[model samples]
Target: MLSRSRALPAAVLMAALLGLSGCGDDTDEPTTTASDSAGATDSPTASTSPSETAAPSSARTDFCAQIPKPAIRTALYGAAIYDEAWAPGKDADVRGGVHAEGAEFGCAWTAKDGTTVTAWLFAAPVSADEGATLVKKAGAGCEHKKMRAPGADAAVTVQCISDDDTVTRTQALYGDAWLSCSLQTPGILTRLDRAADWCDAVREAALV
Candidate 1:
């Protein structure tokens, strides 16, 4: 079974990643085949087999398997008030495959204290280093900082909708997967730490 992500209200965490995709230029390469050429007049007219078809108009790709439930639970650290997993087909693969803006899978853990932690993996063209660079550059205007975990390429940035405590988000790239960790608590300092912890947990699980 597949499920939708339970994220912070659209006003907060959602906007935090708004500029991430736009930071880099659109590079979706168009897919074409020899029979797609206009000059190919002798191309077969018979309907193409489903397997031979190019990209499907609508299809689903499951990516939730990449995250381990036990790891996610452990990463939450504090009491987990909420947790969920998304099954395959809940979403489509990233554009241009798992290296663009198409595939998405994630799980989240909400603490009893109103602190929320979420992890995400987006298949994109950029390597782990490239993704880190983009996030660092894209978040230049925000309160951002680079973080290094033994086995993960990561960064952390804070964005608060209010003047007080807000959400802290950590991002990392593992292989071709873009991993994200978010924490929202009443204290900014705690949130930041939690976010980092989330990243570290993800790194340990992924690198293992």
Candidate 2:
């Protein structure tokens, strides 16, 4: 297994993977090196639902190209406010990121509001169970619920409450990839509704 060090700077930490439950703080996600997003235009794209990612190898690679950015935007109801690629810089973190020993690369999109969603692709050896645990730890507070999303091997929802602030994160681990969506608003019910929809749309997009 490769070593995964938590190297995300404070700015990027706000947007860590299942450590997901997306975008913690409100910093603009930095752009990935051109080489990282180079093959983003490849076609006949894996539209039939991507196979579960194999265990990651020690080698580093970028696999985000397999997913289309346009599709991602549509999945966010065309309300996506931010989109960025995850590379080996500030965005890398101990879990659910490029630094996670086997992550190829990842792409994320955030809605105009505080809804942050991320799709992480891993080619390393980490299992879906391990990935879910990382997300669980990241949301260690409000509520924990295990779910069954259409294409996911395993799914979970975490709600964290700090003072009057309540944030919810719903995530699903798909083989070598995991999708997480987060929302926090003054209206708790509103936050949950959008978070659920975001997670569902992304799951459908990935499965299609």
Candidate 3:
């Protein structure tokens, strides 16, 4: 069975493969540059941070401190879904964004049994209806589900699971973009429960 650390990388690759059509591909390998941090693009350079290559715990502290609260919330939802309790060696990653056309990129990490689960979320242009449909489709076999906040005109949630050793994942989609969340033992259903709670919390937090 796959752990949690491997999920994010696999999802990002899949998003790219499925023609995810994001605004930028910052998470790509070092060979590719990142787009504008505020919505621009640059040639991919070697990752300067240790978390990018180090274990998840170290990475999480590095990330949690750097990322904004909103982004943290997103990551938290992902983590919750994946059953990650913030183990000693478990951590997450959140990158500076480029604000793609209608999508953006964000990542999170988790670890279990010496394995890590890294999840990626890709944002895309998905209508409220479309977002609802996608989540519904993506969240098969999960209950306590309901699509709340609609993606302003265009957005949908695209989720995936990646297990590359101790890493395991249950990705979730929002808008046309994607964000992957990694966790340990809890399967897809647990992830769904967490996802639902994530949506509810985010919606409440962003109340008008």
Q: Model 2 lDDT vs. the true structure? A: 0.41
How close is every model to the real structure, measured as TM-score?
0.52, 0.48, 0.29
Give the C-alpha lDDT of model 1.
0.39
- Which window of ten consecutive residues has the lowest lDDT sum in model 2? 35-44
RMSD of each: 14.4, 10.9, 13.8
Ranking by TM-score: 1, 2, 3
Q: Which stretches of candidate 2 lie over 4 Å from their true place?
A: 1-78, 88-104, 111-114, 128-138, 146-148, 162-166, 184-193
Task: Give candidate 1 regions above 4 Å deviation.
Answer: 1-77, 87-102, 128-133, 136-141, 152-156, 159-161, 190-192
Model 1: number of clashes?
9
C-alpha lDDT values of all predictions = 0.39, 0.41, 0.28
Clashing pairs in 2: 14-24, 17-20, 53-176, 55-124, 56-123, 56-124, 56-125
Indicate the residue-level lDDT of 137 in model 1.
Answer: 44
How well is each residue in 1-208 modelled by candidate 3, as lDDT tens digits? 1122211232333233223232223232111112111111111112211122322221122232233444334534332222211122223332332221222233333322222223322322233343344333342222223333344332233332223211122333343332333322223333444444444433333222
The candidate that achieves the highest lDDT relative to the unseen native structure: 2
